[model samples]
Target: MPAKQRSFAQTLNAVAWSFIGLRRRRDFDEDVGALNPFYVIAGGVLGCALFIALLLGAVRLAVA
Candidate 1:
């Protein structure tokens, strides 16, 4: 059977779970088959950038 395509939101959810290291094996397997590579990479990069920005903002606030 062919893998089903996932929506952008679904891909983002998978990327978020990956970042937090909290995905279940079954869900991971499902996501692996459903997610798009482009969305995964874009979402991961965006998520990382957002995380870094939040950390920097927090540090700046603490120092000020």
Candidate 2:
């Protein structure tokens, strides 16, 4: 049997781009360049949230 495929979020991050009509490769590059700050802020926020959740879970497990 073939291995299972990964989830969409694991394989690609094009959901937002698709909604904005940036489906083409050139359009994607242009959009990315124009939205560099948004991307940076999003990445930072996601990273921090994930880190905090992991830390809290670890502490809870240890205390329990």
Best by lDDT: 1
TM-score (all chains, Cα) for each model: 0.94, 0.46
> Which tens-of-lDDT digit does each residue in 2-41 have in candidate 2?
3343343422344344544567887555445344455545
lDDT of model number 2 = 0.55
Candidate 1: residue 24 Cα off by (Å): 0.6
Candidate 1 versus the native: TM-score? 0.94
Candidate 1 backbone clash number: 0
Worst 10 residues of 1 by lDDT: 26-35
For model 1, how does the per-residue alpha-carbon lDDT over 1-64 read when each residue is reduced to its tens digit? 8789999898999999889999999999877878999999999999999999999999999999
Point to the candidate with the largest TM-score. 1
* Candidate models: Cα lDDT each: 0.93, 0.55
Model 2 stretches with alpha carbons more than 4 Å out: 1-35
Q: RMSD in Å for candidate 1, one decimal?
A: 0.7
Residue 11, candidate 1: alpha-carbon lDDT = 93
